[model samples]
Target: MLDGSDLKSVRKNAGISQTDMANKLNCDRRTIINYEQGVCEPKSSQLFRWLDVC
Candidate 1:
């Protein structure tokens, strides 16, 4: 599973902004920020959705 930092890196490398990621994940941009900051972990389903994006 991808860690917070790893997710951030993948998003960056994919040229996806936090807002865009949030849109795709059906969450707020702050949620994406929180994920990157290690404030909380994404749910398994959410993580899977993100992986689908990758």
Candidate 2:
């Protein structure tokens, strides 16, 4: 599973807000925020999309 640093780095490099990334990936901002905070991990499909984005 990706760690919080990976999530934060990818999102920052992608130049998008949590909300924008969530919209593109069809999830909630809280989900993305949780990911970046290491509060929770993404689901399989969400992980795939995150891979695509990063």
Candidate 3:
């Protein structure tokens, strides 16, 4: 599973913002914030999409 810090790193390295990531994942910006803050984890499908995006 991707940790919050790892997700943040990947997102930063990919040169995307939380809004952009949320758009790519078809989710809310708050969802991206939650994931990056370690408040929640992504579902399998979401994870797949996130991996594809990053």
For residues 1-54, write the lDDT of model 2, one tens digit per residue.
Answer: 679888788878978888889898988888888988999888778888887876
lDDT per residue, candidate 1, 1-54, as tens digits?
547998899889888999999999999999999998888999999988887887
Span of 10 residues, lowest total lDDT, candidate 1: 1-10
Winner on lDDT between 1 and 3 is 1
For 2-45, candidate 3 gives per-residue lDDT tens digits of 69888889889989999999999988999999998899999889
Top-lDDT structure, candidate number: 1
TM-score for each of the candidates: 0.90, 0.82, 0.89
Backbone clashes in model 3, listed as residue pairs: none
Clashes of each: 0, 0, 0
Q: Give me the runs in candidate 1 sitting further than 4 Å from their true place.
A: none
lDDT of 1 at 40: 92
lDDT for model 1, please.
0.90
RMSD of 2: 1.3
Candidate 1, pairs of clashing residues: none
